[model samples]
Target: MSNNTNKILTALAAGIAIGGILGILFAPDKGENTRKKIADNSKKLSDSILDTVKEGKNKISGLKHNLRDRAESLKESVEEFAS
Candidate 1:
């Protein structure tokens, strides 16, 4: 079962690699320009992904801080009520 799964994964990877190679080969730009475009595209994609992750982290952190503040306020209210 594991062997079959590995074979499938390998085949899928090979197919993707081949498709990418063919796409690059048939692309309209000159080789140098094509390389540059690919590099630029890769950088942009990486930057976008990084920025998205950072934004998500900031959102999560803000939520955490807000929750903590609410919890503290609730605790204080309960304490005052019991006094």
Candidate 2:
């Protein structure tokens, strides 16, 4: 994860949280209902975040393997040329 990726994810998470909070706060619902909504929204938010992070991790891992393979190929080419 690069700095920009981290910043973007943080910003996204913050935006989601603030939006959820404001939406719940202004809704015309009883306390019990509001609390239940909050719980459900939080659960959804957490799952969403987890999914995003996992996706990023998989992408980064794939990139790392590709780079490693390319580096090895380049190294073999250079060795063959030098020999």
Candidate 3:
């Protein structure tokens, strides 16, 4: 993924975390309920971010392998031509 895409994802994750916390804090629920809600939301948010990062890491790894393959092919062609 592009840097812009990574930045956007990071921002989105941060926004979700901040928004969820603020909403829970301002809610009129009991302390135990509020804590539970916070824990659930935090777990959800962390899972989402972890998934996205893993996806991005896989994409980048694939791209790296592809580029290496292409570069090796080009090098072989150049060596054949120079011989």
For each of the candidates, the C-alpha root-mean-square deviation to the true structure, in angstroms, is: 8.9, 1.0, 2.5
Name the weakest run of 10 consecutive residues (lDDT summed) in model 3.
1-10
Clashing pairs in 3: none
| lDDT of candidates 1 onward, in order | 0.71, 0.94, 0.94
Q: What's the distance in Å from true for residue 33, model 1?
A: 1.9
Clashes of 3: 0
Off by over 4 Å in 2: none
Name the lDDT value of residue 53 in candidate 2: 95
Return the TM-score for each candidate structure. Answer: 0.64, 0.92, 0.77
Q: C-alpha displacement of 61 in model 1, angstroms?
A: 0.9
Error of 1 at 6 (Å): 24
Task: Compute the lDDT of residue 46 as modeled in candidate 3.
Answer: 98
Task: For candidate 1, write residues 1-83 as lDDT tens digits.
Answer: 24775577557655655665567768887999878766766566556655765776688799999999999999999999999
User: Candidate 2, residues 1-83: lDDT per residue as tens digits?
Assistant: 98999999989998998899789979999999999998999899989999999999999999999999999999999999999
Candidate 1's TM-score reads 0.64
